[model samples]
Structure formats: structure tokens, C-alpha cells
Target: MSRIFVIRHSIFAQIVVWAIITAATITFGLWVLTNATIQRTNRQALERAVGVDLAGMVDIYASGDKDELAKRIGDRLALQQRDGDVAHYLLADAQGARIAGDLIRWPGLHAGTSESADIYIDGTNRAFARSTQLAPNLRLLVAHEYRDLGLLLRQVALVFLTGGVLAMLAVALGGWTAAHRLAGRLERINAAFRQPDDAALEELARGSAGHDEIDELASHSGNALARLKRLAASHRATSDHVAHEMRTPLMHLDNRLVKALAATPDAETAARIADARTEIRGIIRMLESLLDIAASEARRGDRHGLAPVDLSALAARLGELYADSAEESGHVLQLDIEPEVTIDGEEMQLTRLITNLLDNAFKFVPPGGTVRLKLRKGPRLVVSDDGPGIPEDQRESIFEKFSRGKSCFGTEGAGLGLALCRAIAERHHLEIALAPTDGGASFTVTPEFQR
Candidate 1:
């Protein structure tokens, strides 16, 4: 019910409703004005007929006998009745005793007066009537029934009602069609924002030819996305340039430290030079990781040269490569790969992503602990270890670059491994999360399936 309310209150429904209301209101307004005009014209016609009849009867009473005058009035009434003119007449003494007419009694009224009212005659009917004292003891009343006018009014009402219904239907249909077109355009704009890729933005720009709110929004959004893409490319290029420029000097410094260590005669000075070389190597690795992170971020949603990558085969190869290292470290290594698991991605990036996760697992788990890799048919990849689990609070931040957990502060990892993995996972549209395990960390990667 709440969902229905939401839909009804939407712009499309509101447009349709307003159109129907406007059409109905216009239709009713015209109907009311026309009906009133027709009614007034009918009353005026009746008044004219009654006035002429009353004048003739007064002339007859002044010049002729009462009996003769009543006969003339009766004959005129009979002629109008036979012609279906809806007329009535009454002749009476001054004391109000009826002498002749269709009326049962004189409709009580002052002499020399004219008015429109509902009068009881053969039946109750609206009429324009007049009364006059033609002689000292003789009186006359003439009325014209407006029954046909009433019938005409009823017919007009019926026609107006039918027209109102048809108008409502026409307006509602037109309104809905227009609203549907507008809503479709808006939906296209929304879809562009969701995808936010070159192809989607181009599509949005192409659809924004119309001069409407949705079209304007599409135009604005496309511009914004293009700007963002350029900014991201510039940022990635800067990071790459910095990493490459620093690496050459850092490599030279490491080479000098190595030479100095070999030439030194003092054992303590040689050990200190070796420590400096080790720190230099760590710095080089950090620079390389930074370059990789930039590359991964820049490549997101990039479909160039993408192909179906066999995740199962890749995992198997990496498992074999890491097996010896895991065994030498006194840890049990396990692989449960589902056959023929494939995804559309860059094979090199996916390999790095998997390797980094596996390396992190191996680095954290203690001697005699277990590291297991699982690949399932859902294109789900899982790497788990029987090591200290990531703390609840640090699980989210653990994927951030250089954000190592407190427990692994002195561990071999510089914390770029998980961050790189996250970047690669986003590039492939995969959902990666740290699943809670009994006494260890469990990382699950579910690739977005192609339809």
C-alpha cells in the first residue's frame, strides 16, 4: 500500500490527475452555463405565450358574455393541448369559483400579476402564468407548462455527463503518455550517474537534445563526469611520475650503501649500512606499491583489451607457487578451486589481487596455522587463515593504504597489499569483504556476473 502511494504521488501520476481534474472542471463549467441559458430561454418563451393568451381572454370578457368568453378560452386551450403546446387556462368568478379550464381550482394569485412557479394542474409542472380581472365578477388565469424545458434540461445533463467522462479519459491518456516519456528520459539521466563511464556519459550527452529539466541535468552530469575523469587521469600521472623519478635515485643510494658495506672493515658499521640498505629497499617497495595503487584506481571501469580470465586456473598456479613458502614457514596450505571459474578482467591485475591477499594471509598466520584458498562456481574467491582476526573496528580501515591494524604493526606488510586488492576488486566490479571467522580473517571476493 505504501508503495502504491509512492507511485500515485509521483510526477507522472500527478500530471495525469491534474489533467483529468482540469478537463472535468471545464466540462462541468460549460455544462452549467449552457444549461442556465437554455432554462432562461425556455421560461421567456412560456412567459410570452401566457401573456398573449391572457390578453386575448381579457378582451373577450370585456365585449362578450361570460359563457361565450369561457367557451373561447376553453377552445383556445383545447387547440394548444391538441397541438401539444403545454398550455393551461382557467376561467372563474370573482369569488374564485372555477368556470372552465384544465386546472382543478384557480391557482391563488393577485389579479393583474404575472410570475413563474410550480403549479398543480393536470400534474405538478413548472409554468409562467398571469391572472386578470376581466369583469366585476369574472376572472381569468393563463399558464404555459415548461415540462418540455425540464426534459431538455435532463437530456443536456445526460450529454454533459457523458462528454465529461470522455474528456477525462482523453486527458488522462494524453497526460500518461507525456509523463511516461518524461520519466523515461529522467531514468536515462539517473542511469548515467550510476554507471559514470565514458560510454554511459556519451549516451547521456546524446539523449540531452531536448530543452527540459532532465535533458539539462544530463548535460550537466556528463560535463561533471568528463571533468572528474580528467582529474583522475592527471592525479594518476602525477603519482606515476613521482614514483618513477624517485626510484632511480633510491636505487643509486641502495647501490652505494651495498658498496660501502662491502668496503667497511668495522663489523658494526657494516651492519648499520646493511640496515640502511634494508630500509631503502622497503622505501622502494612502498614507491612501487604506490604506483600500483594509482594504476589500479585509474584503470577502474576501463574495458580496453579486457578478456575472460580463468580465475580457477590463476588461483591454482598461485597456490602452487606459494605452497613451498607456506610449508617452509611451518603452515598448512590448502586449495579448493572450482573448475572453469572465469571473469572478464585484466589477468595481470587479478593475479596481483589474489597474490596480495594470499601473501597477507600467510604473513599474519603463525607457525602451524592454516591458510586456505577457495574458488567457487559463483566466481566467489575466499582466502582465510587461522591467525588473529582483524579487530572489528579496523576491518573497514584495513583496506586503506598504510592503515595496518595495531596487532600487525610490526608485521612484514606495509599495508598497501589490501588497499591494492580493494582497488583491483573495484576495477573488476567485484564485491570484496572481510567475512567473520571463528579465530581468523576470511576475505571473500564475489565477481559481478555478466548477463
Candidate 2:
């Protein structure tokens, strides 16, 4: 694999690359060492054979006459040649004259010492000679063909190199497979982080079934997710309690404001009281939206009592309910409904989601503009309006609580409508997105039903 691709994907691929490089480096080093060792051993064995042969020739020269010594050397050389051996022998007299041997000239050597030298014979065939002195004036030389030892070492090196390459290939293949599997497992865990919930967190643990490093990481992640869920549940309960307690006081305040408005005779004081009542009502609505968000989020991953909602009929009914309001706003209401689109979801939340979209559409579209509501075969709900479309930059942020677009500054909404819609859609496991359109703002909610 290419380095850029591997680096972009995962750490495992880089590790595999390093492992193969290290293996190759070690193998090359071993081959060099082994080749040197074999060459040294072969040279040493050849030197020992030459030493023994020179000593015997010296003994024959001392114990026999010169002719007998020459005769003995000639016999030994002849016997080796007959056997097709590459061994050569040479013995010389005090005057450095040619003696009985295949080698023609006497090699230069120090007396009573032994050393190896390169010698050529029979028209430039090279041999390795071990030269030894038999006396102050007499010398002996024994040579073996250099090609034999060189060829043997080459064969040994070739075998070792071939085996090492095969082993490296095998190891690399195995490591690549292992790294690929590990990277896939890690990717799944990483994806789980994007939508952190009990089911997604549990999925990581379920996938990591083997007793490996990835499995251990999954185990730890599952525990952390469990702890986080517990903390969230506790916080939600506290918020609900606080909101509930505050609602009673808010209701009492609303009642007192109502009575004050009734008792007050001054018109200016009544206006102030009515303004306070409206502010209080807005606060109550904001609090209720917060509570709804918490409740919808808490219902995520809950499967008990979930039923298939008829989205087509629901959209048609909601369209009828909002049609007169659209007409009053001087905007045409259009419904593109398929007959029987159904999905598994909470019916109340689905109704609220549709209601919020219709409300948003009517509030935004200019007079004489058209609002289109679609329910299709995929159980998808799309709400689009022809108006100054939502800005590209604000489409995503508009779904956040109290996040209003620049064009919506003068609008009457508290800005939790879209936020509530999002929470409801997520609770139903739906895919919600703001789609790009030529002349309007569009939102689509598709049910990601478990099938």
C-alpha cells in the first residue's frame, strides 16, 4: 500500500509497514554475517589441508633422496589429477628449479612460514595457494581451485536469502490482515462516539468479542458510557423536579396578575399588568419546551409500546388544520401525500413534529408564497416554503434552542420550535436535514426505522 493512504487510514497500517522494513533489515544483516562465516570457515579448512600436505612433503624430502622426494610429490599430484580434483602441488629445489608438480614457477615465500596467495595455472584459471617453506632454500605450495569454495558459499547464501524473503512475505500478509481487522473495529467504536447513547455504546461492546487490545478498550468505553448515561439521567431528573416546582409559582403569579388586571381601574396599570402576564406566559412556554426536550431525549433507545404511525394520514390531517391559517396568511398550502406510509414511532411526537414544521412554514413564507408538505413512500416528511430562504450558514444552527436566523429577528417565536422538532425527530430515530432548494427553505425528516 502507498504511504499516504496508509497514514490517512490508521496507525495499524504504519505499524505493519515498519514491521516489514525491520524484518527486511534484520534478514539482510543475517545474510551478510552468514556469508562471511561460511567463507572464513572454508578458507580455514583449505589452509589446514595445505599445511598437512606441506609437512608430509618436508618429511619425505628429509627422509628420502631428492629424486625420491620429487617422485613422491609427482605421485601425489598425479593421483589428485586422476581423481579430477582441483588440488595443485609444487615442490622446488635449493636453486628454485621446477620440481615435480603441475605449477610451473616457484611462489615467493618467507622461510618457515605459511600464507595464502592467488596463483594462476593452465591458461588463466585462478586458484588459491597456501605457500609454506620446507627449508631455507626448498619450498612447497598447495592450491585449491577458488571457484569451488566461492560457488558453495553463493549457493548457501541464495538458499538463505530465498527463505528469508518468503518468511517476510508470509509475515507481512498475516500482519496486514490483522491490522485491517483491528482498524475496522476501532472505526466502529469511533463512530459510536458521534451518537452517544446506550444502544450505540452497547454495540461497541458486543462487537468486541475477542480477547484482544481492542476488546479491552471497548470494555472500558462501555463502562464510561454507562457512567455518563447515569449522570445524564440524574441531571434530567433534577431539571424536571426544578421545572415542576417552579411551574406552581408561575401559575399562582399568572392567577394574581389576572386578578390584578380585573381590580385595577387605571388603564396604564392594566396595560403594565397585561404586559407582565405576557412575559410570564412566554417564560412558562420556554420552560415547557425545555421539559419537552428533556423528555424526548430520555425516550431515546426505548422500544416499549412503540407503534407504527400512519404518516400519510397524519400529514394530510395536519395539512387540513394548517390550510386555513396558510390562507389567512395569503400563502397557498400544498400537500403531496402518498396513501399509506407508516413507520414505527411515537404518534404524539410525530404529530408535534409535523405541527411545528407547518407553524414554522406559515410564519416565514411571504404573502402569496406557497408552502409544500410532502409525505412519501419512505415515510419521509418534507416541509418547504417559498420565502427569503434560510441562509446557508444558519441552516444548521437554527435548530439550536433560542437560535434564530438574521431574517427571523422580528419574528414572535421563542426559537425552541425547531429545537423541539429536532428532539422529537431524534427520539423517533429519524434522519432530519435542511436540503438546498432553488428559491426556498426545505426540511426533510426520514424515519430510520429498525427493520
The global C-alpha lDDT for each of the candidates, from Candidate 1 onward, is 0.82, 0.79
lDDT of 1 by residue, 1-451 (tens): 9989977878888879988999999999999999889978777777787788778777777787888887986787666644366778888888888899877787778764544455766565566678887777777788877756667788899999999999999998889898888888877776765566788788777655566777777788787877887898799878778887899899999988878877865988888888888888999998888788888787776665579999899999999999999889898999999999999899998999999898888777778899999999878899999888888888879889998753333555677889999899988888788887788999999865521
How many angstroms is residue 433 displaced in model 2 relative to the true structure, after the best TM-score fit? 1.9
What's the alpha carbon RMSD for model 1?
Answer: 9.0
Any runs in candidate 1 off by more than 4 Å, and if so which? 1-209, 262-265, 298-305, 406-412, 447-451
Model 2, which residues run further than 4 Å from truth?
1-226, 298-305, 406-409, 447-451
What total of clashing residue pairs does each candidate reach?
0, 0
Best by TM-score: 1
The CA lDDT at 123 in model 1 is 62
Tens digit of per-residue lDDT, candidate 2, span 1-451: 6867757666887777778888888888898888888778766776667667667777887798667877887787667753344678777766667777877776665435577776677858676787766667677777776545666777877887898888789778988998888878887777665456678788766645486877888777777877777888898889988998998899899999898877865999898888899988999989999889888877675665579888888888888988898788788999999998998878888899999888787777778889999888876789998888888788769889997653333556788989999898888778677888898889889766421
Worst 10 residues of 2 by lDDT: 404-413
lDDT of the structure predicted as candidate 1: 0.82
TM-score of each: 0.56, 0.51
